[model samples]
Target chain A: MQIRKFHVYLTLVMFSTGFLMASSIELTQSTKKSRENENELQQEMSLNERIIAEREKNRSLEIQSLDRQRDISKIEEELAKHETDAAGLLANLEEARMLAGTVPAEGAGIVVTLRDNPSSNSQNVIQNIVHEQDIWRVVNELYAAGAEGVSVNDQRLVTSSSIRCVGPTVIVNGVKSAAPFVIKAVGDPDTLEAALHLPGGVVDVFDGFIKIESGKKENIQLPAFLGDAKVGKSVS
Target chain B: MGQNRKITFILTTISAIIGVMLAVQLQSNLHPLQSESRSITELRKVLLQEQEKSKVLLADISKQEQLLSQYQESLDSVDSIGVMKEELSRAQKQAGLASVSGKGIIIQIEQDPILNEQWDAENLPLPDPSNLVLDVDLRWLTNELLANGAQVLSINNNRLLSNSSIRNVGEKIQVDTKTIRMPYEIKALGNPDTLISSMKLEGLEEFFRSVNMKVTIEERENLVIPAFNGTKHIQHMKPIKAKGDS
Candidate 1:
């Protein structure tokens, strides 16, 4: 029995040592590779830190702009309150601004999200990625179904709005955004949802390609158009 | 037996050392990105994104400041209503609710006879003259014109509004919810030279030529795009109550 116990203990020690040696070899190679790339790693890390800092600063600036916008709205409300004749004018102006997408909007609507196919392979990259045409198709369906307001990735659709393809990303209202484009529409949620699922509509067209999803939301808030809305001064 | 014990003791100690080393290696692997970062290109992408956002945010700040001062001036001035009218007109123009005229280009896309795509080796059903210039094509055309400085646009007399959509419904193409049949006339109120040059650069003219689309881009001395006559409402989108919140 003592001899048997000794054999088992020796085997256990040998097995563990063998496993450890294999792992150590693997680890050493990777560690060496990492050491070789240490300089690049350091540079990348610093770059990441700077990006984070820049983003934080932008968030604060965004808030500043939003605050000022709110203040202007409040003053407009005061004016509309005092001047009865101007009430109609202010109301018309607000409607026009809403249609122009110059102001923030929120109400009963639907959100259509298109993301790159999860099973994307290199061979089918074109089919797997979301294109500007796909976005336009969805937007077209929404408007056809009587959507009153629409925005893509928070870039509100305006008269001068154009979705331009720039490499892999699309520029909506002159602001570039990538795939997984969230399209928010303000209208009858049921009508908007039904329009997309029509026979050979956006759903069928994007079938083996992008992942499209449409859902009704009680309230979908879209921001104001941030791009310059001023036309060419030469236009008379 | 004593020899066996000594050998076993040595093995045990060696294994213990190996076990410690393995743990250290595993720990390091677990914290692989403890230094943290993706690729260099990814880092640059993030940096450029922040820069673009910063640019937009800064522009928004100045715009808001300007609007605030204007509102302040109007509120204090006796001609407050007049100033409000100016603001209203500005919004109206931006919304394409007012007529605009300028030196621009007019594009006419008419159908021509063409067999089909060479890529369709099986001779699939025709993407013939009827479906040659779909709404997607029109959208790209519109994008090109607008990107190259087209201020006001109308497709088949249907003003392209902020909420406009070009769509093909049952073989009929519609712009801004109104059916616009083929032989489309797209009018743009902007610099004609810029629009035409950009169209050529996009190879749009060439592509249309190769297909069943007979396209023409002409420089008009004065192109007028009328106000959007379609229903404009704000039923669903209520301007979020800005008050009662910071």
Candidate 2:
């Protein structure tokens, strides 16, 4: 009976060993196949990852390009605006220069001449003489009549010009002048003549004492002023 | 039996770990961006930065538009403004806003020295006003100069403008409200030869001789006339706007 029992135990041991070896071999083969499959899956996963990374990179670059384009347009618009501003500034500067009398004036105008009565036999010379008030009256009237430019003896009359007398002679623009005053004005000759010849006008006032003659011409040129372009000074 | 049980336990643990890893790999494969939360956070940051940049750019554009509008206002009516400026400047120069200098003639007037000496000392030649240089006489000369193409004139350093007046205020000659003395000097800027010839043509020299007044003429190549020093106060002038205009 002990021998039979020992034989049975040996059989059981062999059977268990055989079954374990077969299963182990099968498990090894399956593991080897699974390893190959895992490798293929890992490769596919890596490729997908690379594709996703590349797509994300492309999208980011597109967004950056759009932002840059917008910035370029904004800058271009600003540049255009600056160019316009520059043009305006230039225009203003040119205007200022002209107004300051730093440039010459040219146009059509009239010349009015005044002379003392040659036949004045009056014992009182004052009555026969042309007074500063007379010229002033005529000049004021010319301006009133819309004279664009007026000069007495080529001295460009500006807003602050003064006509005065010192003793026997009349001083204008700081120079001495004698009889036969010539007043050149740049304007419509007809308008200036009409303005002077208006009822009870400058001509009427000086009718007896002075001989007044005025006529229009085609071309009149006035020179640039030679005085200091002093700041803070202007004629009303 | 104990050894078999231990082996069984080890195999089961290994299988469980492999299954869990496979599940995680599959999940990652399905959704990459979501599975990697870091990528989502990075993209969100980039988007926010881009949006902020665009916002700043938009603000800049708006600011530029405002500036452009201001510039446009000045640009409007540029041509008319240019013409107006030219006209105004011409008027200003004629009004004596600037000093003028040019080649011209100077006429000097004074009492006749020889005639005064020849006059009887006992009679003292009753200070005849006709013989004396009067304000009216100066005014006549000024008017004559203006008529003869004098652009600017000055009497004894006084600049002549449109409103300057020569008057006799008692014994003193008042020019532009200022009193002046003898040997009056009149400066004029023009063509010197024409001015001299014009005065001669008017017989001014003979006229001066008849009145016992001495006149001397000198032509200068370069003369400077000063600007008007008086103030012009306008009390009743105002601009008129056109209809339907701003």
Candidate 3:
């Protein structure tokens, strides 16, 4: 009985030790696996952070490139404007030079002065005065005679002006220019005179109502253009 | 007692084995779902990239369209200028003047007519203001002259063009926003004979006569019409060509 009891105690001790050894081996394996999982998680976290950073960098780069493109477009627009202005200026300069040489230094065509020829019986000639449209006709004829340029009283003609009757006075380029209207043109002396002498021409219509006179002069001087020409937008 | 203990031990062991099986099954099931989630995330990223690319392409297309419009406008302007230059050159040659550079004619129209001597003071007829000359008549004259080959027209030193307006407002006439009063001096650059003859045509001469206004036509060998007196607003139209497009 004593031997049996001792043997049982030895067997229990060996079994317990074996169990402890097996548990230790399992714990070590679990610890190693846990460590490996931790390493893998760290690597994944680092890669994710790098990807996020790269995306942000790319987004910023895109924004910067768009801004640069916009700036370039603005610069190009400004450059185009400058070029157009430069071209306009050059054209104007060339026109001025050409006009300087082409315009006759001296010679006068027919000068037609239109005014309200006072009625011999009426004291108030201003009351029954001339309207603006009649003046436009005479001016038109002078121009048709190849007049290079013209002015109403002191106001010179430009590229964008009109003559119309406002109340009793004739408005010229928005200014009130009164008569005796003196219209001056410079062209072929003989041809200009004949053009005005046409049977139904403006001069013929003047007849007895207004005084129309034509005479050749030794020299006629026309003023140079004083204002700028309006250049509109280019329409294709 | 021994049987009960053995049964309890067997039950505990069976529970442990079942828990291990459950854990393994749960892990396996979760793996595919996680992979699917990752795939969704990657798809979203790709979609975002594609959206950004499309936006850039749209901007490029807009830029190209603008450039094309601008180019077309420039070409049109050049063509118009060329035509004007050619007409001017031809007109100059016809005038027998040097390089077609010389003065034009000046026509003056008186808007008021003198009282008829045949009418007595007691029977004096009042004239209607509208019956007097108008700016339209001048415009007609200008058009006629241009049709007859006048290169340029100016009313009271204001150069008249195709786009010019001669409108009357509340007894006032505005030309390019400027109000002009008569008598108006119409200046034109062309062959004096042709222009005068064109103005003498039926509608024009009769129109003046019907109004009883006095028209004085005089041709000057040299006439200098003035430039327009107003501001020109800038306009930006479309381009005719795309950037870097052949």
Candidate 4:
């Protein structure tokens, strides 16, 4: 009976051990398969999230592009408006010019000539001659006298005209003009001449020191206008 | 004994199934993460492109603004000139002025001989009076004439616009890109008697005498002032807009 019991016990132990080993192998294989499936699901989720994010970014970028285009369009419109306004102004200016007719038209006026008096003392008597300031003074007087247009040595006086002193010569519009400086204008001959001949008139001031001749002419020819007027941009 | 073995086998199998599910879930989660990273990177690139485009557009806008300002300025000048012309026309009509053309007076001014003689011999070089015909003098004379009620002033053949500049370059004077000589001729439209009489002020005559300069004033009933020959360039501070249907 003891031997029989021992055999039965041995058989039971072997069977249990074999069954346990098979079951453990099966469990491990099943676990590994399940884990692989889970990983795949997680990967899919990640992909979906990435797609969603990309779509959002794309949408935002598109919106930005649209805004930029809109801005550009607006700016173009402004430019167009500016162009139109400029054209209108030009037209108005032309109309005014037409109404005024040709500038520097015929009128009654006086012609004044200022020059450096030759030295009567000696050949080397270049000591005192007409100074540039004298010319400037005379010109000032003419302007003060209501003289309209002025020209020195045939050079027309424009808005951009510059008169300066270079050595002993008076440079006007880049040209050296020496005495006698002839000034001609077309306006009220009597009134214009009077303006220059007044007590403080440019000509009157230089009368005694310089040779001042006052006369009247039937008609005087004023030169044509020259040069362009450049108007600067407004900051405001 | 058989029953115990069967139970052990069943437990092991269940554990194996659980392990497999876990592994599968982990793998799936990892795939999604990888995909997400790629998508983010792509989105970043798109954002960069958008930023670059915005910058370009901004530059264009800035350039347009500058152009617009320039166009506006031109318009202003045009308006001013128009007003001046209208006023001038009215004044001319009211004055009953007649067209003038012919030879006029030739007034000459020179430095005073006495003054030159008085100069100290030590100051050998004396200032020349012939060098005073510059933009300042011209501008002064022009202003004076305007003040005195004389109209239609022109220098040489160039018409004096409201916006003109007289600058000196080195020793040369430039007026509207044209070079002028000495002995300026000033013309105006007004009453000669009143104008001439107004010029005989005390200081004026005395000043002329002191400088020994000759100033000749001649009145002409008929005088022809020439038109301006300078080019008129289009100037606009702002972009011009199209006009409404004409």
Candidate 5:
């Protein structure tokens, strides 16, 4: 029985030793694998950290680009507004230039010719003559007809031009002019001509005393005001 | 029996070690990432890289802001010049120194037609002065037109301004300083409708009719009024000095 017990103990110890050796071998292989895995994890961790850092930089750059883009668009909008203002001011300047008589004007208008009566009596010459008042009366009628520009005997009549008689000769604008005054006016030709032919208009009133002729001209050109303009002459 | 008990103890210890080894392997396999940890150096490097990039971006932003302020400064200078240009243009328009175009009316008046039928229409002898259009008649017509809202007026081709005159010298008529003749065409710039309506008012039209005079009125869509051509000779009148003027 003792021999049998001894043999069983010896087998148990041998089996325990075999189990310990196998377990030890497995532990060593697992440790080697764990170490290799730790190295790989370290590499992966570094790669992941680099990716995070790059991503943060890209996000910051993207935000900055967006802010700059917004600022550029705002500046562009302001520049466009200023350009439009400049264009409007330039247009106003042109309108003012047109109004100053330094420029010639053209439009539909009328022409009137006046001559001394060829058939009037030689006796009582004063009654038959076309006097200065007769000329003034006709001029006044033209003004009522809405003539924009008026020129008499090729002499452009301006606001300050005056008409008067020095004896038998007529003085106009500080110069002498004879009869058969040809007055050209710029306006609507149809309206201007119609105004002249009224039943008892200036034309008819002078029918027996002076030869009056008038017609509508489709287009007429009036010279620019030759005199200096008082641009700063304020009434106040 | 004691020997048998010793053997049993040895087998129990071996089995306990095997159980612990299996449990450890299973735990590690389930979550490998949790088991792994990063080194401090790697984290520090990532922080340094991000901070450097931020500094560069900050520098770029400040440079852009400086450029924006410079553009704003130029805009202010342009504004002052624009204001001065506008003031000068307004004055030119008001001086009647500028040519103008607008809708208005034209009126024409002539002498008595009876004088045409008979050279001596009134009495027995010569052409009567009463049969002709007198200077008074023209003056009356001009005043009527002014009352009727004629903004700009011209007689024949002579533009009449504030200093214009209509007078009679002998039997002829003088306007401004020039002699004008019959078949007179009067041009007035204003609102066509208002000017025509006011001209046809009762007493004025009735009186013109009673005199056996012929008057014509017509509307024009576009009329060009000439700028004052005469020199600006301000003899009697002088401009008032402003408080700031020397």
Candidate 6:
């Protein structure tokens, strides 16, 4: 009976050890798959620290920018109050500011959003990606249809604005933005909407490659060109 | 007794492996993401936002500096009117209201000789014209020019303003509503050598040649980019006053 009891205990030990071995094997397999991710997580922590520091720097610079902007505008307002051509020039200057996209604006317009085909089964990936040409097409169409003001991802398209593609990101007004580009143009909402919807229009041409949808908004707010609109001397 | 001892040894080894696995699993749990569930994608999104904020704020600081210096110059001048007029003209030029003439480069893109030959030979059923002057190509070219410091740009006399757009509309290319045909002449006012070198460096001409388009780049001393005659009236966009007192 003692020998039998010893056998029972040995069997129990073997059975439990086998179970533990099976479960641990599965656990280690998953952990092996996640080891690369562990390294990434550590890198992500460092990235977090750097971003926090950058944001703090930006906050202070923003305050300094606001102060300088207030001072310049104050002088401009004072000068506009003076005699004759000054007021007219100020009015023209305001109009130019609108043209230069130096001031924020809001009006009835249409918002067109373009994004990558989420389920694109196309063999050519490059064709499906949103190229700068794709953006130029839509913006051109909007302007042709009489869009008074246009902004791509809220980066106002100034004379000097260059839209280029770098890797998977598109840079607008020198700011990097990923997909789901939002283009807002201040114009007759009906006209802009119809222009994009015309047969073989921008939406149709970009059918398989990009997914485009537009809506008319009563109050489409657009920010000013945050980038420098500082122009050098125009040689006569 | 020997058989029992060998079994016991095997069981101990197996348990030892299990212990190591358990310790490793515990270690992984202890070293989870800071938020416990944040994915790499979410972290990247936050990073991109922070980077954009920095870029915008940096540009803002520089622009404000330009404006402040202009204000000081206006205050220092004996003739504030002259200073305001100078500012107005500069704004006008940027708005494409004032005509600009200077040293720059002209890029012309048109149909290849083979394409016209094929069109004539193929008759009504043209073989899927591929290399015709595409608006996208023009946009790319003009963007390249602009990137190379081309201050003023125009397509076929249609001066590109701050809001100007070049687009392919119904088989024709339009520069802000002005339809331009084949032999697209793009005029850019800037440094001639810089523009020419950039065009060459981009291998735009070679790329166009391979794609069945004729490319001509010329450096001209007296290229005149006319003022934008198109009415860009500030109809919809109401300028938000910088100062509330105004």
- Best model per TM-score: 1
- Which candidate comes out best when scored by DockQ? 1
Sequence-dependent TM-score of model 2: 0.37
**Stretches of model 5 off by over 4 angstroms after superposition:** A1-100, A121-123, A229-232, B1-94, B97-246
Taking the tens digit of each residue's C-alpha lDDT, what string does model 1 give over A207-228? Answer: 7778999899999888877656
TM-score of each: 0.76, 0.37, 0.32, 0.30, 0.35, 0.69
- C-alpha lDDT of candidate 2 relative to the true structure: 0.61
Candidate 3, residues A78-142: lDDT per residue as tens digits? Answer: 43465674355333323332232221122445555667766634455553355555666665555
Kindly report the docking quality category of candidate 3.
Answer: incorrect
User: Between candidates 1 and 6, which one is better according to lDDT?
Assistant: 1
The DockQ-based CAPRI class assigned to model 6 is acceptable
The number of clashing residue pairs in each candidate reads 0, 65, 85, 217, 51, 0
What CAPRI grade goes to candidate 4? incorrect
Candidate 1 lDDT, B54-121, residue by residue in tens = 88779978977987788777645346777678788888888888887778888998765442344355
* Each model's DockQ score: 0.46, 0.02, 0.02, 0.02, 0.04, 0.38
Model 2: DockQ vs. true structure: 0.02
Tens-place lDDT per residue, model 5, A1-236, is: 86687677668766765776687678657865876666765676676767687767756664664465345335544444667665554344333332333334455778888777757755565656666667666666665555655666755565334455566666554446788777777666777677677787787788767778888786665543333422222222
Model 1 TM-score on a 0 to 1 scale: 0.76
True contacts kept of 6: 0.59
Q: Regarding TM-score, does 1 or 4 come out ahead?
A: 1
Instruction: Considering only chain B, report the TM-score of model 3.
Output: 0.52
Ranking, lDDT, top scorer first: 1, 6, 2, 5, 3, 4
lDDT of 3 at B162: 23
